[model samples]
Target: MDHGRPKPDLIIFDCDGVLVDSELLSCRCLSEVLAEFGLQLSVEQALELFLGRSTKAIEQYYRDLLGQALPDDFLARLRARVLETFAEALQPIPGAGAVLSKLQTPRCVASSSDLDRVSLSLDVTGLAPHFGDRLYTAQMVRHGKPAPDLFLHAAGRMQADPARTLVIEDSVSGVQAARAAGMMVWGFVGGAHYRARDGRAILSAAGADRVFAHMSDFWEA
Candidate 1:
């Protein structure tokens, strides 16, 4: 925590881009799968549209664009490919493990991804031990990012007041959700997926109280 900001009662982490560097891998896999279903998106476009969203969001996106429902099997296919790719190549964000190791604040994961994917991401990156069963997912809420429901849910479950929670996120929607939930948020831009864009400005515009590029700077003011 920074000296300028009140120490948080609890910290809520968004898994994909904040804890695990899986945004690029997941987005590329999503693009490949969507192409097979007659929807095309470059990896950059996929990241832009779905970086902090759920599979249900993806399905609805394609449904709106193509003007019909995606095949019932679409989410299943996407999840399988993403999990397989994750098991093979996912890694934690740079300095993520060290930060978690040193932090004394109570913390938990609340991600837009499913529990299965969030669990596997942590396990493969050697980050699972830090969270244990404190992981939360979009499946736990009726709505996902850009909606305040998920973050609010996590804060309640963790027994922290929403106003006293700190949300660390790497996407606009995540930052927005945290703000909507009345929590202070720091926008993280250290993931491989952010290397090509101005993530700091984007997240700041989305209402992040702080925007930082590396996990090593997590406590800096």
Candidate 2:
């Protein structure tokens, strides 16, 4: 039964859309925050521009658009709102818990979110025990997704050979990053946000080796 490519030595998962169903809430918050700055962004637009990107990248984009740095309290306020919202509304992706529980490969989470947000997402969804200190965030690297730095850093730290690592991602930037890291990559589109968005198309365009639409459908690597 074991045929074709070599089995993976490690698995890497992205957080928001891949592990937890937080993208809809996060994009809503992004829409709200950007509206205050007179940009009038819709949740779909926010998802297009900010999904799988770090807070620093988002802030810099806003600054570039507005021609000035954001207010000191902007990030703090956003974080507070997002954390409160997560405590109340965040949920794990459908079947993600069962999939993680059954997975035999050593796995870790690597996300564009900062450590605090990543930790809280895992905590709220009961996925924390699955990963614990195995979490890696873009803040831990010099560059985020689409640049290969974060994926390379995670693979290096996990002691996984890039050639034998399997990456599961839900965004274009994340897929690009994992592929650039010299690893096998699959695109996941299980998040509710994909209902109205064409995430799979973008993921395919970004060069994922395979694409799956549900956690239960994840391929064995």
Q: 127-165, model 2: which lDDT tens digit per residue?
A: 999998999998899989888999889889999999899
- Model 1 misplaced regions, further than 4 Å: none
Which residue pairs in candidate 1 collide?
A: none
- lDDT string, candidate 1, 170-208, tens digits: 999999999999999999999999899999999999999
Clashes of 1: 0
Highest lDDT: give the candidate number.
Answer: 1
| TM-score to native of every candidate shown | 0.97, 0.94
**Candidate 2: where are CA atoms >4 Å away?**
1-4
What overall lDDT goes with each candidate model?
0.92, 0.87
lDDT of 2: 0.87
Which candidate wins on TM-score? Answer: 1
Q: How many steric overlaps are in each model, in order?
A: 0, 0
